[model samples]
Target: MSEKFRAYLIVSVGLACLFVTSGVGYYGFAVLNTPVGDEFEWSRGLIMWAFAFFFIVRGLVAPFIGRITDRFGSKKIIICGALTAAFGHFLLSQVQNIWHFVLLYGLVGVGMSGMAIIPVSSVISIWFDEDRGRALGIATTGVGLGGFVLSPVLAGFVIPGFGWRMAYIFLGLVVLALIPLVMIGIKEKPKNYSNDKEDDFKSPDFEKNDVRGVFSNLSFWMIVVAFFLTSMSNTGILQNHVDFLTTTGGFKLQVIGASLGGVGIASTFGKLGFGWLSDKIRAKYCTLLSFIFQAVSIIILLNASTLWMVWIYALLMGLGVGGWAPLSSVLISKNFGLTSYGGIYGIVSSALCIGTGIGPLIGGYMHDLTSSYYQAFLFLLVLYAIAIPAILITTLKN
Candidate 1:
């Protein structure tokens, strides 16, 4: 095969990998949140903790996963991740209690970290240099696409017809199916590509051996702070979205499922749109624009009493959050270069994971306390406001 064909193939594999990992592992969790809670008669906080634990585990392991990708290449790790995540889903089908659920979900988290942005981005960054943003945008669009399809499938068909336990098994099967795709398509970068090349992209500073200096880098921390806050805000709303609509908005399960699926579709467009736009404009400006979409969506959500208003919120929020994954990789590569891309991004992802873990818990806690999600969402908006400056001020001063 030509190098160009090989490059595009890698992107296809990356997209398929995320579609399963985030689809079954991430978005799948949100759809299951309510049924699992309702079945066990657990508090919203406890239910949210399981998700929190899942992301926290992913965060804890992200740095290691990144380093492993740096050392061993991403192909092996991606294979292992597929198996581990599928096993986690299968185990989830047999959970008899909350502890069993949380621990098993954390195991899934470990698997998902392997398949997530770090390794995928590491591989993609090596393939296309100038158009990396567009490549990443297309690859990561799988995340939203998976959610768009899977949310309704779980909500309307799988969970309702087979039950949540069967739903877990179904998700497992979906993940297991990706093994062939990974085995056939995933590959290391070209032999001509050297990760150690700092000038591969135009940045103000590139360090060949400055892995240690990454810790002291101002731009790195700003990215960390921005993503952490953004994830917390985004995840808080997402994890609680179903319950909020069910209890507060008085919507039926089918309607809620449809709305979530619509969000997924909007996010797909967001990833593609913002991803391409990032290459044309400054990634910073594109990111800022995406953030604005999310922030405004939240405002619409706060006042949403009609179904149309909620749908509007879904569209805007999808577009906003969709840009996050690709832009994150773009920003890191733009500023830090790909030499330590895995490790640097791993740490940043760790912070984002922590924020995601906290988000659901905060939303759950606020709901349990107030018997409403209003306060939790308001608090999330404040975090969004704080994150804006962190991203805005981040500059490659090195």
Candidate 2:
């Protein structure tokens, strides 16, 4: 293979593995929630905190990983992330207590931070320019595709057969197998490459100010705040959707599992479509449109009483929510440039993780308090509305 093609293959494989690892690690909690709750006689709220712990650790670790990627490159970081993820999954297989769950999930969070979009996208962004948007779209599509393929299988088989523990062990071994590929295939461009040459890629521009500088940019703040609200809306709905369907909509577990899988399929298309569109249009406009779709989907979801209604809602929301993932890096790259892309994007991504971490916790807690998802769904509607104006304001700026 040509060196360039080899590089793309390596990065693509790394991204695929990262996406699969993240999909299983993050959504594994959702599939296992009811099973774990039933086993321990724990409340749904308590079981859901495992996801919260994952997001919190992801939020804290993202910026540091970004910085390390900027300074040291991605090979070492990705290898470490893969290994941590493998170890974390092994730990998850052995968990018997709440603290064990928390610690293992936290390790998964750290692993995700090291392996997630920021680190991988930073490397991909550096390697291509002519097809950067398309490349990124292709890379992130792995997340939606992985989820589509795995979530239902997990819900139907893993949880029912050897239990969630064995599922973790199986997933851990799979992630471990990818580490050597990442270590060998990924590389930064030659340092001597001329930025002005047509064939050479230009690095992102960074202001001399450090991480604190990102806080001063209004556009950065808007992206952070908007992403936070969106994350809350997305996670709140997804993490508890099965429970919501069972308790409120009177759906069977098979129906709920199938619907979740269907949503994952829709999300795969959404990620690709929005990513391709972002390349054609401005990323800000793409993001705004995605938020609008999410708002409408949430409103529709609020009134869903039948399985079909919920499925349609899930499809629409998946398109909107899944699209947001690729557009995030596009918008950040447009505004900040690549020089500080990793660190700055990492900070913004942290806010996203925080929102994701809290959304399900708050939603589960609300359900525990009210015995219905109505209040949480309404809260999500309000958040989506709030995000619209923030996106408009940020996009309008130079």
Candidate 3:
């Protein structure tokens, strides 16, 4: 194959991989929460805890996975991740206790950590330069697309027809099926490959240093803090979305599924839009704009009682949340360079994952205590407000 075709092919394969990993591991789990809670007589808080714990595990292992990807490349890491994730999902289908469920989900998290963003971004970084933002944006849309297609499939068909157990099995099988694609399609960076963006790392003294070097830079920390807050806010809303709709708005599963699908669609557009914007304006400014979208969506959500209002909320929130993945990759490359990108991005992702883990737990428990999502959503809004200034500060001249 020609060099240009090979680069695009990597993107295509990466998108497919993310489609299964994020679809089954993230959005699919959200759809299953209601039925899973009902079957086990678990509270929403407990269900949220299970997911929170899973993401925490995913975060904890990300650095190791990134380092591995850097040294060994994507194929091995993806194969291993897909196998582990498939096993976890298969076993998760058999769990009768919450503890077993939580632990197995953690295994799934570990598997997904290997397969998702870090390695994909690392490979994409090595391939494209000038068009990196759009390339990353296009590749990561698999995340939103997965949510769009899988959410309805689970809610409307799989769970209803074959039960939640069969749904997990189906997810496991789909993940396993991705291994062949990776084996055949992915390629390591050529030995002669080089990037001019190395000069872009903000720290001069630490240019040759390891991951510790970036720690001394203020922009790095700002990016971390900003994403942590945004991630926590976005994840809190998404994880509890179905429960919120059912209890607060009294929506049915089919309707809620469609709403979730709407989020996926909006997010897909958000990723592409913000990605293209990253090339035009500063990455931090694009992030600020996305946050504005999210904050307004939350406001709409708080008072939403009608179907149209909820759909509006979903569109705004999805667009806002959608920017995080591609923007995170862009910000990292702009601030830290790509020589050690996998490890550095891994650390940022770890922090982001921590926020993702905590958000749902906090949102769920708040609902348990107050018996309403009003207080919980307000907490998220506060996080968004705090994050805005943090992101803006990252764009200032050193």
Residue 210, model 3, lDDT: 54
Residues 1-398, candidate 3: write the lDDT tens digits. Answer: 88888899999998988898889988888888778989889998998888998889988998888888877888899999999999999998898999998899899999999999998888887888788889889998999999878877887799999999999999999999999998888887755787655665444435554577777777778888988888888899888877788888888866777877888999999988988888778888989999999999989988888899989999999999889888989888766777778888898889888889999999999999999888999989998778899888764322
What are the per-residue Cα lDDT tens digits for candidate 2 across 155-238? 768767888788888788877887777777777654454324421221233233356666656767888899989998888888
Any runs in candidate 2 off by more than 4 Å, and if so which?
A: 190-212, 395-398
lDDT of 1 by residue, 149-187 (tens): 787789879998999999999998888788888788877
Query: With candidate 2 superimposed using the best TM-score fit, by how many Å does residue 62's alpha carbon deviate from the native?
Result: 0.8
Model 2 local distance difference test score: 0.78
Per-prediction TM-score to the true structure, in the order listed = 0.96, 0.93, 0.96
Query: Clashes in each model (backbone N, CA, C under 3 Å)?
Result: 0, 2, 0
For model 2, give the RMSD to the true fold: 2.8
| lDDT winner, 1 or 2 | 1
Evaluated at residue 16, the lDDT of candidate 1 is: 90
- How much is the lDDT of residue 348 in candidate 2? 79
Candidate 1 RMSD to the real structure: 1.7
